[model samples]
Target: MAWEIGAVRWKVALALAAVLVAGCHGAAAPHAPASASEWHGNGAMGAADWSKQLDVTITIRDYGYLPRELRLRAGQPYRLTLVNYGSVPHYFVAPEFLASVATRKVEVREQAEIKAPVFTSFELRPRGGSLDVYLVPLRPGTYRAYCHVKDHLAMGVEGRIVVE
Candidate 1:
């Protein structure tokens, strides 16, 4: 009986170790956008083919923002770049205070209450595009940066940024 109990404990320990390793080394989805995408423009006399990342290392795609989540600290400004990687023209806009709360969340997260907004904002043209807007995370929290084009965000064109 003692031997059996010891063996069972060893098995449980091994199982936990395996789970910890898998959790620590999890991989990102393959279809996910990279730091930057290789998009080409097919202009109908439009720069749409030139879709590219502007100043922000993160980006918004047809239905999502690559890095859909971001992290930052308070009082520091960030140059967020955007590119119309999707078929339609898209832009980034959000309340300024909320934007700050987002980047301020940094490494910690929990329930958040939106008092106001924190972002200025920027726009991008169609057939591939790019734009840059400055950002500063103030109160630490989480927020979504949504494109307010008609039915745009509903189509999955939004991202989350966490500030600290």
Candidate 2:
């Protein structure tokens, strides 16, 4: 009987861990915000509401991000646009920042949009590729944003995202 109890406890712990890992890695669909009315059933925002979101554009250059510092207010909606103007592909890697936000969707230009619970990185294609990340800051902290494509961070391709 004692061995059976121990085995049950271990199984429960392993199942809990699996659930946590799945949640962190966004294996499940994103949950809606507390204000259900703010989101449509189809997950696409109304066209008229787009103008109400704060627009923040981050330009991706050859080896750096313009406006190295980004300031955002917690609990506010933002249309974060990422535009790559480099000849080569670059990445926007900010694991902590992405995990702390309530992501609405990530719309990749000329492609399908992604609706996930979290995003860790974005690969920006060369020359005029752009993506839009619609999210609301859920945590107030500073996070490091960098590119990890072949020593890109060492080459001064980095920035900071500050959530207030």
Worst 10 residues of 1 by lDDT: 36-45
Q: Please, what is the whole-model Cα lDDT of each candidate in the order they appear?
A: 0.55, 0.81
* Local accuracy of candidate 2 as per-residue lDDT tens digits, 1-164: 99999999999999999999988667443543334433432233333245568999999988799879999987778999999898889999998888777777999868889976568899999898899999877679999988899988888788999999
- Top candidate by TM-score: 2
List the RMSD of every prediction in angstroms.
16.9, 7.7
Q: Mark the 10 consecutive residues where model 2 has the least summed lDDT.
A: 39-48
lDDT of 1 by residue, 44-64 (tens): 112222133123566668787
Candidate 1 lDDT (Cα, 0 to 1): 0.55
Model 1 TM-score relative to the real fold: 0.48
Q: What TM-score does each of the candidates earn? A: 0.48, 0.70
Best of the candidates, lDDT: 2
